[model samples]
Target: MIKSMDEFTLTINGKQIETKETIGVINPATEEIVGHAPVASKNDLDLAVKAARSAFPKWASRSFEERSELILQFANAISENQKELASLLTLEQGKPLSFAEREINMAVYWLKESANHRLSTEVLEESETTYIEKHYTPLGVVGAIVPWNFPVLLAMFKIPLALLSGNTLIVKPSPYTPLTTLKIGEIASTIFPDGVYNTLSGDDALGPMITGHPGIDKVSFTGSTATGKKIMESAAKNLKRVTLELGGNDAAIILPDVSIDEVIQPIFWGMFLNSGQVCINAKRIFVHHDIYDKFVDKLIEYAKTVRVGNGLEPASQLGPVQNLVQYKKVKNLIKEAKQNGLKFAFEGEAPRSGYFIPVTIVDNPPENARVVTEEAFGPIVPLLKYQSYEEVIERANRSQYGLGGSIWGKDIELAKSIADKLETGTVWINEIGALSPTIPFGGHKQSGYGIEGSVEGLKEYTNTKIIRINKR
Candidate 1:
C-alpha cells in the first residue's frame, strides 16, 4: 500500500486552501502509492481564477525584459534541479528515468527559448499626415490544462510563453502526473508574485470550472479529442478563447526504396518511446508491398531485444503503461484484434504481470480493428501493406484523426511528395516524432485544432491591437 501524504495545498490570491479530498499518486511499476495530490473542488478552481485575474494587471504591466529575466531565472532553477525533478516525474508518472530526465531538459529548453522570443515594438506603414501601429497585449487570466505524458515540458510550453506574453495563468495538470507540475508551481512562487501563477490539481470537473469561469480570458488544453470538445462547449458559454492539442492516430508510411532496417529504427523510437503514450506516436504503419514481409520480420527481431521493467532500472528500455485503466484498455484492444483474425508477433517474453505488455506487432491488420482505428496509446503497432502510393495515401487519410504522420524512404523527393498528400498538421519525411521548440505543433480534422509551440504559441495568448492616427 502507498503511504498517503498530506493534501498538496497551494496558495491562490495570497491565501492557502486545503481540500479534504486527495488523490492517490500511484507508481505503476510496483502498484505502490507514491504520493498524494489535492483534488481541487469547484471552490478551489474559483480561487485559482481569482488569483490569476488579480495578478494579471501587475504582470502585464511589467516590461517584457523583466518577465524574460525572471523566466530565465526559473529556467536556471529547473536546470539546477533537473535530476530531482526527473526522479519525481518517474516516481509519479511511470516513464523511464532517462525519458523523465529528457523531458526535464526539454522543459528547460522551452523556458529559455520562450524567454528569448522577441516581444518588443514593431513598425507599421507610415504615410504623410497619418500614422499606424500594431501592439500585442496580454489576454488576462489563462487557464491551461496539461497532460500527464510530458507534464513539465507541456506545462512550460504554455506557462513561460503565457507569462512572457504578459498573461497570468491558472494551470491544472492531469491527475496522473501532477507532481512535477506542482513542483514547478513551487519553484515559480519563489520568483513570481502571489497570484501571478497558480497550480490546481483534480479530476475532469475542475476543467469545466476553470474554462467556463468568467474571470478566465483563455483556455489552453492538451489531452483527448473528447475532452477537448467538452472544453470547447463549456468555454463557449463565456466566449473564452481556446487552444487545444488533442488526440492523434499518426501514420508512418514506408516507401519502396528505403532499407527496412534504417527506417524501422526511427519508427521503433516513435512508436515505442515512453511506452507509446505519446500523442504523435506512429501507431499505424503502411509499407509498400515489396518490403512488407522483410520489414515485419526485421521489426519483430529488433523489438524482441527491448528491455522492459521498472523505469528506475537503467537497463530497462520500456516502462510500464502509466496506469491500470490504460493497461486494461490496451490489453482488451489487443485481444479484440486477435479475435478479429489479426496475427500477433512479439519480440521477447511477455511480462508475467498484467501491467507490462510487450512490443506487439500485428500484421495485415484491417482498418476496422481498434488497434488501427483508435489511438492505442500503448506499445502496439499495426502494420498494413499497400500496392501503390495512391492506395496508401487514401488509407492514411481515411481516419477522422489527423494530428501527424511520417514517410520513410531513401528517395527524399518521393517521400516529400507523398507527405504532401497526408492530411496532418505536421509530416516527418524519413523520420518520426522529431519535434522541436522552433516548429509549430497541432492537429487537423477530429485530431483537434489550433497550433502550439513556435511563434504561433506565443501569439495564441495575445490580443493584437491596431492604432491609427490621422492628422489634417
Candidate 2:
C-alpha cells in the first residue's frame, strides 16, 4: 500500500524524475500538506514529448489484440494495489474512503470495457473492378488534462481509449489531486513501453504548455468551460486535436406522477453525490407545482439523514470540498443566498475547520441569483418550481452549459419524451446521471466538445484513412 505522505515525482520515459521545484499537495479534508509532488520543468516536458514521439511508431504498430491484453494487465495491477490507491485518493480528494474504493474499481472496469472496444475496417464500396477500405490510424502523442473531481475515474475514461487506439499519452493530473493520478503512470510503466504513458504534476503553467506544445498531437481535457476555451485558443496555435469535457449546470425535472419514496434516494444522491462535485451531478432541480411542496418536504426529510465529516470515518457520507478555493466559493454562495432572503427548506450549518461545508440546499431563489445560474460545483443545490413541462424544459436549457440532464416520472414514456428535448449531452429518463463505457458522452454547447467512452470516443484518438484498390 502506497502511503499518502510518500514523496512523488514526475514520470518520463518510465523513470521517476526528481525536480528542482515541487508543489505541496494537501489533504483537503484536513487542509494539511499530505506530501509534495515534483513539478515538471520546461526541459522535463521536452524530454517527455521527445520520448513519446520516439515510441509512437512502434507502439501504434501493435494489433488491437495485443493492446487489449496490455490494458487488461494494467487493470490487474490496479486491482492488486487498490487498497493503497483508495487511501491515497480519499486523502487527497476528500471523498469518502468507500467512494475512493468504488472509483478505483470503476476505473479498472472501464479499462477492461474500453479494451474490448475496437474498430473493424469498413468497406465503403466494393465492386468486381474496384474496392475501397476505410479504417482508423493513431494520432501520435495525446495530452490528457484531468480535473480534481473523480481524478482516477476520469483518467480511466481517457487513458484506455487513448492507448488502446494506438496513441501515446502524457496525463497531467490536477495539482490538487496528483497522488493517485501519478501512481497510475508508475503502475503502467511496469507493462507499457517507455513513454507510452507519462504523468506530470505541476502548477497552472503545466496545462498551457501541454496544450500549446507542437509535438503533442491531441489534448483531452476534463475541467471548467472557461479553461476549456483557453485550451482551445492555445491549441489553435498548433492546430492540435482537442476534446474537452467541461463544466455543467445540469437540471433534473420531477413530474407529478412519480412516487416520492421510490425516487427520493436516487434524486438525493444524484444531487449530492461526492458532495455535489460531479460534472454530471444534478445541480438544479425543477419540480412540478402539484408536487413541489410535498417533494421538497420529502427531500429535506431524507437529507437530514446525511452526515458530513472527514472521509476517513466509516460513516462519513459526505466529505469536505476538495480544496480551499471551492470551499470558499460554496461559503460565499451560502452567504449571498441568505442575504438575498432566500428561504431554506432544510436548515443546516457548516463545520468550522478544514474545507468542510454542510450539505446545503437552497430553496427556489430568484432566477438571477448566482446559485441558480452558475455551476455551484459543491454541496449547495437550488430547487426551482415549475408550472408546466414546456416552461421546465425551457428553464433547464437556459444555462450556458449543456453537459447532462435528467427527467423523472412514473410514466416512463412521458419522461423519456421530455428527456429527448433537453439540450445536454446525456439525458436520463426516470433516472439521474449514469455513465457506461459503451455510451458516447459529451456536452452540447459550452460544456465543451468531442466524445468519450464509446467507439466514437476511440475514433477521436485516430484519423480515418481510405485505401482504394483496382483490379488490373
Give the runs in model 1 whose Cα sits over 4 Å from its true position.
1-7, 14-17
In candidate 2, which residue ranges exceed 4 Å CA deviation? 1-5
Q: Where is the poorest 10-residue window by lDDT in model 2?
A: 1-10
* Cα lDDT tens digits for candidate 2, 1-472: 3333387878899887889999888998888988888888889899999999999999999999999999999999999999888999999998999999999999999999999998889999899899999989999999999999999999999999999999998999999999888887788888899989888989988999999999999999999999999999998997899999999999999999989988999999999999889999999999898998999989988988888888899989989899989888888998989998998777555557889888777788878899999999999999999998899989999999999999888888888888889999999887777899999999998997999998999999999999999975
Predicted structure with the largest lDDT when compared to the true one:
2
lDDT value, candidate 2, whole model: 0.90
**Alpha-carbon error at 429 in model 2, in Å?**
1.4
Candidate 1 lDDT tens digits, 1-472: 1111233655566444567888888888878877778888888877788778888888899998999999999898878788888998888888889988999999998899878776555658688887878888989998889988888888886888789899998888888878777776777776788898888888757877787789899999998899999989988997889999899999899888888777677788888998889999998999889988899888887887888888898988888888898899998988888777788765355456637777888888777888888999988888898998989999999999999999988889888898889999999987778777667888999887777888777888899998888865
**How many clashes (backbone atoms < 3 Å, residues ≥3 apart in a chain or on different chains) does model 2 have?**
0
State every prediction's TM-score relative to the real structure.
Answer: 0.96, 0.98
Residue 234 displacement in candidate 2 (angstroms): 0.8
**Most accurate candidate by TM-score:** 2
